[model samples]
Target: MPVQQLRSGDHAFVSYADDDAGREVVTTFTWTGLARHEKVMVFSSPRTDESEVWNSLDAPGPLLGAARERGQLVVSSMRALIHPAPHFTPERQWQRIEEETGRALEEGYRGLRTYIDMHWVADLDADIAVMMHRESHAQHLFTDRPYTEICAYDSRSFAPDVLTAMHRAHPCRLLSRLGELHVEQTPGTVYLAGEADVATREQFLSAVREGLLRTADERRLTLDMSQLIFLSAACAVDLLRLAAASEDHGIRALCHPTGVRILRMAGAENMPNLLLSEVTR
Candidate 1:
């Protein structure tokens, strides 16, 4: 899912192939939390320098410095966090997180969020079984609580089986980044922006499918494509088929002239439940 779609109580997992790819999502996660008045904590990998994390978050402006000065943003490591404990234990770590969440709430923040690089597992020489157990059983931390977390796994560090297992274990999985296309959503609408061509066709379909499922019982589902720069013919056909399949619900698409033309050519006019509105500036 897009990072923008993540909300409180979402425990998301993301795996990255390199530092650049990893930083892309973490940067957005950190800044978004700060903007939402949520205390943000980043636990750097043992291999990463604290200064590098600080520089990445502060790239656009001095806002990160100000946030740090006020204690809204913290960049630290797992080793330091579990201090006074002789070794890594799930109970000990979870206890500290609960305490931190309470501290954030008491300090006048809306909530607390943490981005933990999974390299800490190796750094602490923790047992793989114990870590996996912790990951699968950590739902208690998020249930009915205002804490959000992202567990990042470095693809190069962990084996394929381990990565796949970890991915399935998490309740939420985050898209690496919103590269060429962006999808945003509300209760009854899914907004598509950027280009939806052959390359991004799958993503477009997935987002639209999710929106349809969410609004299945409602009278209408809106696809706001006012900001979409380009729509391919194949994608238009896919949209038409989806609308045709969901006979009971109406699909309303707000699009520019180009998109309208593509859909019209793809037989949008024949689908009774599909409504297309031309949006003009």
Candidate 2:
């Protein structure tokens, strides 16, 4: 999922292949948090210098600088967070996080969000089991309060099995970066935005299929393509094929004029289960 969609109480796990990709996520995450009036904290990787993090967040603007001046944005490390404690313990970490959340609220911010790099796992010489336990059991921190966190894991730093386990540990997972396409699903609808061409065909099909399965018992399922900037003919045909396959449920596609035309050219009119409705701009 795009980082922008993350809300309070969401704990997201994100993996990055390189520093560039990682920076893109954190930069966006930080700006989004600041924009939402949430206190933003970044726990730099054990090997990363704090200065590098500062540089990455510094854009060609004054917003970041002003946020820093107000103490709303902090760049720190895990070692500093659990200070006075000899070592890492789930209890200590959780206690500190709870205290921080309360402090952020007391400071008049809506909530607090942190981007923690999982390299802290090895930095603290902490047990992997204990770390996983912390990740899975940290829901209390977000139960009703407004707190969001992202545990970033560098792909090169952890083994495949460990990475997979950590991915499952978190409730939400973030996409590496915002690519050419994005897809999100709700109860009975699938929302498609961005360009949907051969490059994004598989993603487009997968989201539609999942939406169909989720809304199978309902009378109608909606494919919300009004936000879609471009739709390829191949993807249009894929939608028609899926609709044809699922004849029991009606698929209502809400699209712009161009999208409707693309589907019509792809034989959408012939599919009895598919209804194309043009959305006005």
Candidate 3:
């Protein structure tokens, strides 16, 4: 999914292989933030030169440059946000985040959005265990706040374990390749974005099942499918079956009118625990 589609409190983890991709990721995120009247912050990765990031963002238009002048767009080094202190503590860093978020709101921005390069961990030689703990604990900030963040990692530099940990810690990620199936889970909702067809059915099913498994303790399961462009009949039926099988919890699905029509045609009304609603907007 693109950063433009993310909600105010979303936190995402994106892994990029090269500078070009990394620049694009950060540019889109900051641009969206500025457009939405949100304060934008960028903490450049050790692998990506700060000048390159500025060039990509500044090339778009005079808007980004103007925002920077007004202090709405902030570009800082990894050490700047992390150093000047003896130790890196999650509590202290998180407190700073909360304080900044509040300050952004008071400053009249819609929210505070940031892109942090995960390479800082390696650059600082920070302990992996402590950083991972912080990463997981940081999810609390996204649960309910006007904060959005993207932790972009240099795939070439980060260890596989570190990348995996980041994936599990964050609630969202970009679509697997430009326009395939992507699913995200929030406090009480599972969001399905992009298109899913027979070719992507297995992956789509895995995502849905994983979401259900994660939220099994809850009594209600909600899904937002408004961003889904298409769904195959087989997938529609699979959704109904999953809902029916989980009768103990009430299931709600919000999707485009087309999806509602498809579900109805697939006998969705007969499925237990499943309620399909149309998102006309």
Quote each prediction's TM-score: 0.71, 0.73, 0.67
Q: What's the residue-level lDDT of 5 in candidate 1? A: 54
Cα lDDT of candidate 2 equals: 0.88
Model 3 Cα lDDT, one tens digit per residue, 1-281: 65546778888888888677777768777878888999988988766676776778888555566898888999886567655665677876787788889899999999999888877887777888998888877877877799999888788987898888788888887643334677777877888887768887887788777777777888777888877878889999888788777778778889889999999999998876788889953
- Rank candidates, lDDT, best first: 1, 2, 3
TM-score (C-alpha) between model 2 and the true structure:
0.73
**Which sequence of candidate numbers ranks them by TM-score, best first?**
2, 1, 3
In model 2, the Cα lDDT at residue 7 comes to 88
In terms of lDDT, the poorest run of 10 residues in model 1 is 173-182
State which candidate has the highest TM-score. 2
lDDT of 1 at 208: 93
What's the alpha carbon RMSD for model 1? 8.0
Q: What lDDT is obtained when candidate 1 is compared to the true structure? A: 0.88
Give candidate 1 regions above 4 Å deviation.
180-271, 275-281
lDDT of 1 by residue, 70-180 (tens): 999999888888888978999989999999999999999999999999999999999988998899999989999999999999989998988899899998877765555
